[model samples]
Target: MKNLNCKNCGGPMLIDPSGTTANCPFCGSKYVLDHRDTDYYRDFYERMRGFLHLSADGQERRRRADELWDSAASEVFECSDGRQIDIRSMHTYKNRIMTAYTARQNIIFRFDIGNEDKADRYRKNVSSIDYPSADTRSLSDFFPRISGGFELADATTLLVVKKREDEYPLRLFGTLSGRHTAWLIGRMENLCCVLEYNSIVHPEFGLDTLYIDPYDHQASLYGGWWSAVPNNTAVNGRICTTRDNLTALRETAAKVLGFESASAARETEDVPKPFADFLRSTPLSNAYEDFAYWDDVLIKSYGERRFINMETDDKQIYGKGQ
Candidate 1:
């Protein structure tokens, strides 16, 4: 995929959900595709849709071919004793506290200098999560599982966590349909309930911290554990509570619906009033109550629970020629 740049200011352009237009976030430049460009994107979208309609075995073969089409980039790091470790990564994510590299079956988080304690906190927080005995959902599997930790010779700390091969960062999907975002919100509500059950407040709970198995319609909290704390703990001169988690969920839903914030979400044919109201309304006292409220909204929004399969590929998600 080729990155699209703004012709006016030479800045990167963000493709709209319609895929025929783009906007430059840096320079406020807008671009509409020419006829030739539109035809190319139309053909690309058709091929992606055809791939999605393929049989399970056919999809598997295509996935294998995609793996061969894309190669992981490698980086070498030296240990204190002069030993070298090679990391082959397919994707990289950066936040204030750490830079994460997606290395097939594991995610390697390299914490900023002087933030080693946060790395330890991450491990402890994930390990402390508890689930009810009657919970057959295996909710714990979605949280991070610490594989190992290391101190590089460069003084940065690395925390290695295991992840499933099928899980990809939710942000990789870009903006999704309202139906897709609805299911994501339901999954997030389940996760928030678990956090509330343990009285944990995850400050950085949002799209960047989330992973999704689109094929299974499942979501996972795979990042931002370093910033997680117990409910009501004071952080940066403010109280953090379970409410923060619910709020983040709403914000994430709004983002996938192409809105800047929950308050900005408007009702449309696709995004019904109930769905918009859920995002805009204030969260209930705790995650339990909030989730129950969302359950009501979910039914009101779509009437009944049905798994809607959203078939998409990298080009359809990130954008054509990007």
Candidate 2:
């Protein structure tokens, strides 16, 4: 038996090795075990936290995140702006390495560094879809939306830059004492929200090549483009990616890519409508609800893409004339 806390009540509970259900003693709530994976537990706990309106715990989460940033900044690389660029993030993925470094100041400087091999792979995969002419020009030509020109330094590292405002086409967000970092983070989260949406709508998307260019608040996911800039919420303000525009974009892309959905997936299951719903119902204080809501969106977006892809492949095999 393993001791764990109840997701709903946060009270103590014990799990039997032979049993599948976890019953909460205090709340009398029962949750079925799902694979018992670490990620499943994380999600389970997060969902419970959200259900309990546990934003108060966010302060601790924020503190831990601050510590991570501080640790990342412990060893600094000086930048042109007299501020330091630290390794804000870096990790290895199979044969590839992905890293993000930042200098938070009046003008933020963020550099996304990856392995040349990985960059080349991405370049090859996305170029044809992005470039109608099949032009294999420079990296900038390949991902034109990325203002930060590619820096192919040595045989190892490939760097792409993006910022709030690109003085040099690719830079970092910096305005009034790191205010843009929040926006940059928000931009990244928004892209994840979209990717989560895509993962549900198309399971194969896998978010493997999900790229968010904060410079323009846009994203590229498995060759599809997405607008991820957050909408203002003034009393009479409007939301980004209105239902009409999203439907148009989806239909246009589907037609261009020859995605003939015999039975089109429900539009409400995607991010646009549900996100809009979140914006309407969720108060400013419960901003954390947005992440939980988007997670649900991502889960729902899966499998739908797999079916569409299969149908598209069938069309390719049978013949476009048919």
Which one is best on TM-score? Answer: 1
Candidate 2 local lDDT, 106-165, one digit each (tens): 112222343445545444433333211334222232232332324333223333433321
TM-score of each: 0.79, 0.25
lDDT of 1 by residue, 1-322 (tens): 2246789987656554345666775778889977776565555434333432334575674585366337667888776677777888866766556778877788899998888888989988988988866653499888898998888899988889898776766655556766668878989999999999899999889866898765566888989998899999999899998999999999989987878689999998678898999999999999889888988998887676754333544344323231
| Candidate 2 TM-score over all chains jointly | 0.25
Model 1 pairs in collision: none
Cα RMSD (angstroms) for every candidate in the order listed:
6.5, 20.4
Q: lDDT scores for all predictions?
A: 0.76, 0.31
* Top candidate, metric lDDT: 1
Cα error, residue 215 of model 2, in Å, equals 18
